[model samples]
Each structure stands twice: as C-alpha cells, then as structure tokens.
Target: MPRSLKNPKKAKRKNKGGAKKGEASSSSSNGIPSIPAKVWQPGVDALEEGEELQCDPSAYNSLHAFHIGWPCLSFDIVRDSLGFVRTEFPHTTYCVTGTQANSAAANSIGIFKISNISGKRRELVPTKTSNADTDMDSESSDSDDDEEAVNDGPKAPVFQVRKVFHQGCVNRIRAMTQRPHICATWGDTGHVQIWDFSSHLNALAESETNISKDATTVSNQTPLVKFTGHKDEGYAIDWSPLVPGRLVSGDCMNAIHLWEPASDSTWNVDNKPFVGHTKSVEDLQWSPTEQSVFASSSVDKTIAIWDTRLGKSPATSIKAHDADVNVISWNRLASPMFASGSDDGTFSVRDLRMLKEGDAVVAHFTYHKRAITSIEWSPHEASTLAVSSDDHQLTIWDLSLERDEEEEAEFKAKTQEEVHAPTDLPPQLLFVHQGQKDLKELHWHTQIPGMLISTAADGFNILMPSNIESNLPANTAAA
Candidate 1:
C-alpha cells in the first residue's frame, strides 16, 4: 500500500483557519510565508530528536512523504484551477531546499509543478517546466473569472509563479520600479545577479520546444537586462520606480553605479555613493508614491533620501537608528513616510518632511528579538508592511484599523491572531517565501499580479494559490 493511503484519512481539520499555539501558519500573503504546522513539529524535534527524525517520512505534510531537507523554503503563488486541469497554464510551483554544511548540494535554483495548493507540504512534478505562466499583463481577459481562493484572509495570493533563481546565503531580493520586470538578487560574492524574470519565460519556452512534440512555440520574454559592472558584490540595487529600466547598484566599494538597463552600454556613478552616510550602505527602497526619489540607510546610523535628477547630495538625511540600518521601507499608505530597522533590536518609520529624530517614527515595530533583514510594503495596500528577520520570524503590520489589540497574546508584533479569516476580495498577494534555512531572497511572479517565486539560502520555491478553489479538485466550485 502507498504511504498516502497508509494513514490516508485527511488529518482532522485542527482548525479550518489558524494554527495551534506555538504552531505556525503555512500560507503567506506578504513576502514571508510562515512555517507550516506539518513541518514545524519535526523541526523542533530535530533540534532535540536528532537529524534522522528530521529526515523521517512523517516530516512531509503528506503521508506520501516528499521530504524537503530541513533547511528548505516555501513560497506561495497563485494559479487558475480550470486552466490547470485543462493544462492551459504551467501551474508552476516550487519549494527551495538547502544542503547542510558539508552537504554535496551545489546551491541550485529550482521550480516545481504544483497541481494543488491546499496544504503546507507541496507535491513535486517529475519533469521540469518553463517559469512563465503568470499574470504580468496589466490587462488580461484570460483568467478563471469564477475561480475563488480558499483562505483569502488579508494578503493571501491568488495567482501562480513559474520560475526562480537561487545562490547560497542570499543577501537580498528587491523588486524594481520598472513595470512587470526587473528584480535583483545579491550576495557577498562580489557578484550581484539581477534576474530578468521576463527572461525566465523565454527559458521556459525554449525548454518546452525540446519536450513535447506537440507543444506550441510560446513567447520568450527575457529579463530586460543583467549587470555585473561592480568589482565586488553590490550590497544594494534599486530601480527608479519613476523610470523603467533605470537601476542604481551599490557595493562595499562605497560606490553607486547608475545603470541604463535597456542598452546596457551606459552607467553613471553618483559623485561619491551619495556621501554623508559616513559608513557602509545596508538597505534601500524607492519611495512608493514618489518617482525618482528613493531612500538609503547605512551602518553610520542614518537614513538618506535622494532624487536622482538632483545633485549627488542626499535630499534629506536623518540619524534614524543607533546601529547599522538593516531594512528600509517607504510607507505606501502615507506620503513622505518610510520605515527602518536596525541592529539595536528596534525599528522605526519616519516622515520625509519631518526633522525630528526618533520622534518622527509612526510605529515602533519590534517583536523579532533580533535584527530585521528586510521590510517590504504591499504593492496593492498602503500601511500594510511585511517584516523578516534573523529571529526566524515574519510579522505583518496594519496601521489602518487595529483588530482590537485586546485579542491574542502569543501572536507577536500583531496584537492578535487572524485565524486564517476569510476575505471578500480575491487574493492579490504573489509569493510568500519563508526559507527552511536562513532566508536569502524572494521574488514575485510578474504578469501574474498575485503569484510568487522564491530562492532561499538553500534552493528555490515556486508558490501557487491553493486557497483558490481548483477546477480539478472534485469538491471545488469549478468542478
């Protein structure tokens, strides 16, 4: 008998919505998907029961027990159930797994075929597929209009992801201001590899031609361009959301290179890496509501906002943190406002127009017991931000309407637990990439507004929308 059938009955619905105490939720509406309950127990035990138990078949979310090494990551993407059953789209899904120290894995990039997205553990396909199949087009008529997502609580995704890129111990992944294209993945290797997701689609097309004899030739949209002008790894790269194809990349060399990606023939260096920070640059973000204006933070304990059209001097500077600035995010809901986290085990948000020091911060987001790695704003929602850190935790912040701060106590950062509540709108989130090991990078599926792909410190994960009802699932509305 097959393992899936051994204890075949669907595990009792612990709760159709939230996880038990000390238990984590699996899906991600923001960029960092939380660890699944199924994988968490074994992991805790692994820390106690030893490595073998961590590798046991029971570790898989499914009875069939597909084991993703202990240090893996999962991303949540979106999909079209009807199209998937008809095989219209790639239904591309993935999970990034890592190699233990001294393990023989070569730090690879991977994509998995996911037919279902209803649980924490995902089923993998035998053969590889292209990484295209997303909803990049600002306009589209080809979608499952009747398809609905399952647990579309705040921030859940309702699309699909096709491809991913991974390198070991990633430094950061950032979305460019450019339209439907441009994302950067960097590390300490002195090499900042900017993945042109548009190109991933073409790679998929080329691979498709070699596989099925009847497969039709599809479009091959490559990443607009890739760059390697730095002599060292660019610690930070940001796209001028105001101008498509324009990028600014920086490295430990203390130099910022402006890139014209379309032609790749020109680059301009800021007078002196936007001097005045007086230390190494750590993180950056383009003002969500402003064009050509962006913010940068550094170990010098300050934050600087710049306008590329203006001279090399920072437009405004603030000694925002007591330690190295780790992550920065411009609030999308409020103008002239942004947030920063530091090594001091604290985080703060500032208003560009204000000169007050710590007095300028709107929310003091601190729950991660450690340094925050990054803070990403929701492209679709204002004030809603996602934070990830070395503390092995992901926290979501909503400044609009507090859900009664009186509710839950164990749910850090957030005053309460959502219990995987339901939503009236379709999930607009793309990928929620929570790494199995230390998280390195995350990417959103282009073309598909609500899909995502992620590369971890280990491998890669392609997330699809399982909360969305599937046409193939016998009990789905589409069925």
Candidate 2:
C-alpha cells in the first residue's frame, strides 16, 4: 500500500448516503446485488435497526446498490454507473466480483441473479436534498412527465451476500466480444476466468448454499477458461480491441502477455514474462481506435505505451505519477489522448504525442480525497472523463482550454484558430452518482451517449443518467 493512504477505509462518502434530513434517497440506482428496479420509492418512515427493504430485482429503471467490502480494495474495477447498458427484459442479468480483505491469495468471485432478489433494502442516502446533486427533473418533472414514481412505501431489510466464486472477489471485469463472455480476474489470485450470461442459472444454482445436487440443466455450469500465464496476482485484462480470438493481460510482473486460444479450445502464450515496471502492473488498456497501440500503468509510478508489434522497451515510457497507478484509459475518438489514475490520489490526462519521459502530465485533476481507483474516457466525447477512487467519489473533468471563458479572449481565439478546432473540448463528467455509491469500473453502453454503467465491490449496478442539473446534492443533515 502507498504510504499516502493511512486507512484504506477512510472513505469520504461524497455523492450520496452520507447525511440525513431533506436528502432524497436513491440517487443513480447502482451497487445492488441484483439488477436494480425500474422505479424506486422511498419509505415514509425512517429506517430502524434490523429493518430490511426490497429492491427491484429487474434492472433499475431509475436506481441500483452495492456492499462495503474489504479495505484492501473494492469488489469490482467497474462500478454500476449510468447507461453502460440496460434493457427492460427480465432475462438481462449482471455480475459482481468479490474480494477478501487483506488476503495475499487472489480474492474469489461471486454471481448474483436479480431474479432471486426481493428483500429489505435501504436508500444509501436517507436524505432527499443531499441527493439533489444531478437529478433536476427527478425531483419536479417525473410526476409531470408521467413517469411512474417509486411509491413512498414502507422499507425492507438491506441486502446480503448469497454467492461466492473462486473463493475471493473480482478485481476487474471486462467483456470480450469474441468469447462473447464476461472475464473476471480476482485480486489475490493470479487467475482469470471467462463466464457467459448463458451460464446464469448454473452459476446461481452453484452459488446457493442450500441448493442441493438435485439441480439439473446445461445452464447451471459455469464453463471457465483459466489462464495460468501470470505468475503474480493478475491486475487487469483487456480482450483484444481489434482481433476477436486474442486477449491481453498484465500483472505484478510489470509486463503484458498475449494469449491466443487456438481451435483446439486450449490457450497458447505468445509473449513471455516481459517486464516493464519494478512493481505491480495495476492496469492495461488496448486502444480500440488503434490496432498496435496500448497503454499500461503500475504501482511503480510509470506509464508505458507499447506497440505489441515491437519486442524491445516500450515505444514511449513516462514517469506518470508519484504513487501506484490504478487504472489507464484512452479516448477512442481522439488519437494519442489517454488518462491514468494513481494511489498518489490524482489522475492525469496525457497527450501521447506531447508526453516526454519525465514530463508525463498534460493536465491533472486532484479532487479525489483518496487514491484514484479507476478511470475511463468517453468513447464518443473527447473532452469528457470519469474517474472513481478509494475516496469513494466519481468526478468528470472537462479539459478544454476552450471551456475556460476567463482566458484572455485573444489567447483563446488564437489557440482556437492556430489549433485544429475540435467539435468538442476536453473531458467532463456529466452526471455523478447523483447521490450513490463510490464508482468502480464504468462502461458506456455501445451507442448511448448519456447512459453508462458501473459495478461496485458489493453487488450489481446499471445506471441511466436522469435529465438533471450538475451539482453535488445538498449536504445530508443529521436527523
């Protein structure tokens, strides 16, 4: 752990679920074990001890939830945010990764079916005004728009864990199109497994504690592909953004490997224990827009850009941050623009073209009070970026030198004319939790601009940004 972080659990509880009074409950429906409800209604009365509440078992039309896992890290690198992907169909299900606190062994993973869910739950944020950060229409326009609101009904008990896989929790999860499955790599264990939604029922049955051997069917078994290449606990995996049958993985070894699954259903390694850093390789990203480009980060405090087509040292290596880099992301629409987060508790936007060995940071943001845990650049928008951290907050930043109206009109106009005028500016986070859990990994739905999704350590999450204002909700007042 970086000496910068004293208590890994010293969570700041920024966007939601912090205070009481006037704060409306249920911001973006994220972090629930099951898929969230289409509608969520707050209770008329305050929650009492031992009380349970029922959450929508189906995808949250408007909201979701997650659990507080180990202090070592979170459950999922991808958290339930808004608009990653959501459908009204009841058959659509999401998965959550689990992590055992302080385990040297890789944390196991778990599966949760939204269907089996229907129990007591609580609004992470009990206050109404405090949750008012992003949803301008949620408070006043939903009723007029004729969207059915959550009934101001009685509450139920909070959710509990039901399933465990691989004996630990997932550190990161990525969807591979070729395998057409979700691939999860645990925190302590150096193993990665690929699972499919088709295995939903089998995983559910296998996960249940009371379920007997009487269960039958092909869907109940989770067909797995475990890669034994990484010697240390694996940190991240990205399915080849270009090729379908190939995948890339990184680990504490400070190197990346390409795994080719041949026709025989067996896997072959094309790269050896290549080395890049002296510390753990925390994250890696293969650029979808570029076939030969990839970016990686590590606790060793360096960022490397590799052309897998080449064999020697990285084509470009930048001393990125003072602490461990947790995640790396690239702007698909913008060439040479990428982002990275670190334990030093900051994130940087670097222009690969302008980046130099020691001069790594192009623009930096330091709002997070804890280590920046995860980061993602907009797939469509160039200037918008979203980040999550150990501090339990998600922030979007816009880096356009253009958005700065205060810039000397002469300078701004000059830069605009001298430089290629982009249809957009820098990066910006459009909607925060609107009052919800800390962000984990965030994915934008294939084509939806405002819709995004995230998964927390606790459970499942799917989010849709509401037509709302941009501001942290009012502070939660004590009851």
* Cα TM-score per model: 0.55, 0.62
Residue-level lDDT of model 1, residues 1-479, one tens digit each, is 00000111112111111111222122243445444222222122233221111111111121111222222322322222232222223233323222221222223222223333222322321122121211211111112322323233111112322423344433444444433334555544565555545444344433422222112232233333345556565456676656666666666554555665544433343334555566667766777667677778877888877887787778878778777886677766576667787876577766666555444766665455566665665443565555555544334455554543343234322423233322321122211223223333344332232233433333333333322222233322332
Highest TM-score: give the candidate number.
2
Model 1 lowest lDDT segment of ten? 1-10
- Given candidate 2, what's the lDDT at residue 302? 86
Q: CA RMSD for every model?
A: 13.8, 13.0
In order, the Cα lDDT scores of the candidates are: 0.42, 0.49
